[model samples]
Target chain A: MKSAVKIMFLSALFAMCCFSGNARAYEYQGVDIRGFISQGYLQSTDNNFFAETEDGTSQFNEAGINFSAEVSDRLRLGVQFLSRDLGTIGNNEVILDWAIADYHFRDWLGLTVGNMKFVHGLYNETRDLDMVRTFILMPQSVYIEAWREAISSIQGAGLYGDLGLSDMGSLSYDLQYGTVNLDSDKGAARLLGDQWPFEGMGLLVDVDQINVDYTYAGSIRWITNLEGLILGGSTWGYQFEADATTLLDTTNPMAAAMLQNNPGFVDLVGPLNAYGARFMLSPSEFGVETVSYTASMEFMWRNLVFAAEYMRTTYNIEFRNSPLFTTLEPVLSANGVAVQDGTIEVDQFSSVGYYASLAYRFAPWFELGTYYSVYYPNEDDKDGKERVAKGLDDQDHRGWLKDIALTTRFDVNENWIVKLEAHKMDGSAILLGADNPAPEDPAEDRYEEDWYLFAAKMTFHF
Target chain B: MKLRSIPLIARIVLAGIVLSAFGGFIVPAGHAASEVMVVAHGSVPVESLSRDAVQEIFLGRKTRWSDGQKITLATLKEGEEHEAFLRMYVGKTPHQFKNYWKSQVFTGRGKAPEAFTSPDELAEFVTNTPGAIGYLPQRAYQNQLKSFMIE
Candidate 1:
C-alpha cells in the first residue's frame, strides 16, 4: 500500500512538472497546480518540546502539492497530498490531506463531499500552508500539535454558504460531519499512553489503533462592516475508541520478582509466549468523547495584523477491563481503593486556552510578529496545587503553560519565505509523556518549569 | 548562557526595526490619482457597476454577471497600476490580495484569477474572453473592450 501511494505521488509530480513546462497549459486545460516545500530547524535550551528539540533536531519539515480544476460551470474537483515530519510526530508519511468535490448552486449555498478540511478557529484550514503565515509554528494553545491528525480533516460531507448583508457586511458558514483516521504511533496515542497509572512499575502501554467513530464540526464567521475585520465562532465534537496492549518489563528486578511470586499473575499475563515476553497483559479498551468550542477574531489594516482567540474543550475518558488492573486490584485494595469491575473512569474535565497575536509589516519584505499564549490542562486546577496534593501529578507547574513568542519573517520573493522565531515558556503542561519519560525517582520533577525554544525555517512554493 | 545572549538578541532586533522603518520610506508609493479604468469584454451587458459590486466580483464572492454569464477574471501580476487598482476598488493591498487568492485556491474555495505580465497581455485576454473583466491604466484602453463607469 505504501509503495502504491508513492507511485501515485511520483506520477502526479511528473504530470505537474510536464504541464508546468508549458506555462499556457494551465490556461488551456483549466487546471491549476501548486505546491510547497519547507525545511525547518528547532533547538531548545531544555525539555524535548515534542521531538528531541533539546538536541537541536532538524526533523521539522513539510512538503505538499495540490491540484484543482473546474469540471463544470458549477462543479469543482480538488485534492492535496502532504508529507510532514516534526521530530517523531509526522515521520514524513505521505497522506491525502484533502480531496473534495464542491458544487456551488447559488451565491448563498454550496455542498462539498469527500475528505474536507476541518474548519476551526481562524487559521485551521490554512495552518499547513507555511507561505501564508508569518510564524513557522502556530500558537499551540488553540492548535495543539498532538490533536492535529484528529482535527485536520474529515472524510464525509459538508454544507457551506455565504450570506451578504449589504452595509452590514457578510457572513459565511460551514457544517461538516465525518470520521478521522488516527495513527497509532502519533502524538494522540502517545498522550493516551501517558495516562496509564502503572507505568511507574515498569509497565508500558502501546496504543495499536484509534478509530474515531464520528466527528462533527461547524463554524461561522462575520465579515463586519469594519474593513479587514473578521469575527468567528467554531465548535467540534468527537467520539473515539482505542485498542492498547500493556507489557511488564522484566528488566526491572522488582517487577520480575513480584510477577514470579504471584501465581495469580499467570491469569493476568494471558498467552505471554505469543508476545515473546514473560508477561503480556490482556488487551485493554480505551474510549474518549470530546467537545470543543473556540471564539476567534482577526483584524488586518494596511501593514498590520492582529488576531486573538479563546478555546475550551471538555473530555470524558474511560479505560475498561484491563488485565493489569484486574491483577493489581487485590493488591491495591489492601492500601486503598481498587479498580471496580476492572474499569477506570477518568472524571470529566475541561481545558481552557487563549492567545493574542500581533504582526506588523514594517517593510514590504520584512514583518515582525509576537504573541502571548496561555493554556491550562484543567480549568478546575488553575495553579495545579490541588493536583499535586492529590498525587494526580508530580509538579504544580504541570497544570498550565504560558508562552511568549517573537518572530520575524522575510519574504525573499513571491515564491520564497524565511522565518525566525523565539519562544519563552513558563510551564511544561503540554509535553508528551513518551518524549519526557517518567523518572526513576518519584520525587524528582520530570520536566523543567521554564525553557526557551528557537526555530528557523525556509519555504519555497510554486 | 541563555540569559547572557538576551541583550545581544535584543540589540539585533532593535537594529532590524530601525532598518525596516528606513526601508519603508524608500518604497515607491504609486501615483495617487492615476486613472484606472475597469474594462470588460464587449459582450458584457452592464455599462456601469457599484464599487461594492466590483469588490465582490474581484474577491470571488460574485461568480456571475447580471445576464448569468460566467465571470472570467484577469489581473496583472504586479505593477504600480495593479497596486492602485486593488487598493482603490478591492480595498486590499497587493500582498493581502495575493494571500487571499492563495488561501482560496489552495483551500479549494475558489480559482485564482488569470494573471498577466503586462497591461497589453491583460487587455488582450479581456478582449478575447467573452465574459472577462479586468482593470487597466487609461493609456492601455482600447475599443475592443468596454469600460465600466464606476457609480
Candidate 2:
C-alpha cells in the first residue's frame, strides 16, 4: 500500500514538471500548482545526528507539491503532498502534508478546516522550504527534528484573522484544535521505546499504536508600531495514548540461566508465559500529556534580519501493566517504598530551549548567518547532577546541549539555492537510544559530549 | 612591499570608477527611470491610490477593486525598474517580494502574480486584462494604460 502511494505521488510530480518547466507559477483551469525539491548532505566529527552522519550521509532530502484554487471571493481550497527523508526519521514516506478549506468573511474573521499547519514559534510553518530560508538547518533548540512529524500539522479546524489596531499596529491570531497521526516506525516510537529501563536485560519493545486524543494550539503575533519588528507568543497542548508489545528473549543462555537461578524473577516473568520461552507484554498502556509555550521576536532592517525565540514544554507520562513494575516492586517494597498496581507515574518535568539568530544579505546573491542555541531536557536538573545521582543517565552532559552555528547561502538564481553550514556542539542531550545503543558494560558511556557537524544543501523550487 | 603597491591599487580603483561613470551614460534612460509609475487598465475607476493601499493590493490583502472587478496583478521578472517599484511602493526587495508570494501560494494564502520579461509585456498584459495593476519606469509610460498618482 505504501509503495503504491509513493508511485502515484512520483507520477503526479513528474507530470506536473513536464507540463510546466519554465513557469514557476502554473495555472490549469484557474487552479495553481507549485512544488519544490531539495537535497542535502550531512557529516559529523564525533556523534551521529539523527542518522549515520558521523560517516557522512546524503539521505536528507525533501520534495513537495501543492495545488490551490480560489473557489470564490471568500473561499479557497488547497492540498499539498510531501515526501522527505533523514535516515530512519522520515523514511521518504509520501503523505498528505496539508489539505484545507479556508473561508474569509471579514478582516477579523476567517475559518479553516482539515489538515492545517501547526503554529509554533516563528518558522515552523515554513521550515521545510529550504529556498525561503538562509540556513540549511534551523536551530535545533525549538525545531527539534525528532518532534517534527508530531507537531508538523493537525487534522481539524482553526480560526485565524488579522485585527487592525489603528496606530498600535496590527495583530494576527490563530487558534486550532485537532489530532495528530503518529506512525509506528517514526521517531516518536523509537523515543518511546528508549524510555523502557529493562532494554538491557534482553527486553525489546515495539510501539504498536499511538493516537493523540486531542490537541490545542494557539498563537498571536503583534506587528508593533515599529516597522520591521514583530513580537509573538504561542502555546499548544496534547493528550496522547499508545500501546506497545514487549518481549523477553529467553533464547540467550545468560537470560535462561538467570531465570532458572533467580526465583524472584520467575514471579515477574511467570505471568507473561505465552510463547514457549519468549514472554510478551501486550495491551500495555502508555499515556502522555504535554503543554508547551513559546515567546518569539523578529526584527528586520534593510539587508539584516534578526530573530530570537524561547520555548518550554512540560510532560506527564504513565506506564501501566508492565513487567518492569512487577520486577521492581519487590525491590521498592524492600526499601520501604509503596508500589501502586503495577503502574509507574513519572513525575512531571519541563524542558526548556532558546536560540538567537542573525542573518545578513551582504550581497544580492549571497547571505551570511549565525546563531547560538541551547537546550535542557529537564529544567530542574540543568546541571544533570540530580539525574546522575538518581541513576537516570550515565553522563551529566546528557541534560543539556549548546550549539554555535555559522552558515552561508548562495542564491544561484530565482529557482535554485545552495547553502553550507557548520556547527560546534557541546552536548548530546537529544540523541535517540536506538541510534546510539547502550554499551555492554553498564559503566561505559555511549556518547561523546563535544562534537562538530557540517551540512550542505541545494534546493530548486517552482 | 604593500606600501610600494598602494599607488597602483589606488590608480586601478580610480580608473574603475571613471569607467563605471562612463558606462552609466551609455545605457538608455528611457527604459530605466529614477521613479516608478503605477498603472492600471484604462477602464478602472480610481485615478489615484494611497501607497498603503497599493501595498495592500500587491500583498494579496486587498482582493478586489471598489467597482467589484477581480484585481489581476502583473509584474516584471527582474530589473532596476521592478526593484525600484517594489521598494518604493511595497517596501520590499525583489528577493523578499518573491519569497513573500511563494509563501502565500504554497501556503494557500493567495495566487501568484503573472510575471513578464519586459516592461512592454507587463504593460500589454495590464492593458488587456480588466482591473489589472502593475508598475513600470516613468519614462516607459504609454497612453494605452491609465497611470495612478500615489498619495
Every model's DockQ, to 2 decimals? 0.44, 0.12
Q: Model 1 clash pairs? A: none
Best-fitting candidate, scored by lDDT: 1
How well does candidate 1 match the true structure, expressed as C-alpha RMSD?
3.4
Q: Mark the regions of model 1 whose C-alpha exceeds 4 Å error after superposition.
A: A1-28, A197-203, A249-266, A270-278, A322-340, A439-444, B1-33, B139-144
Candidate lDDT scores, in order, read 0.82, 0.79
Clashes of each: 0, 0
Q: Write the per-residue lDDT of candidate 1 for residues A85-111, one digit (tens) a residue.
A: 888888777899999999998777999
The ten-residue window of minimal lDDT in model 2 chain A covers A330-339
**Candidate with maximal DockQ:** 1
TM-score of chain B of each: 0.88, 0.76
Candidate 1 lDDT over residue span B54-93, tens digit each? 8888998888888888899999987888888888888788
Candidate 2: regions farther than 4 A off:
A195-204, A247-279, A322-327, A332-338, A441-444, B1-33, B41-50, B64-71, B128-131, B142-151
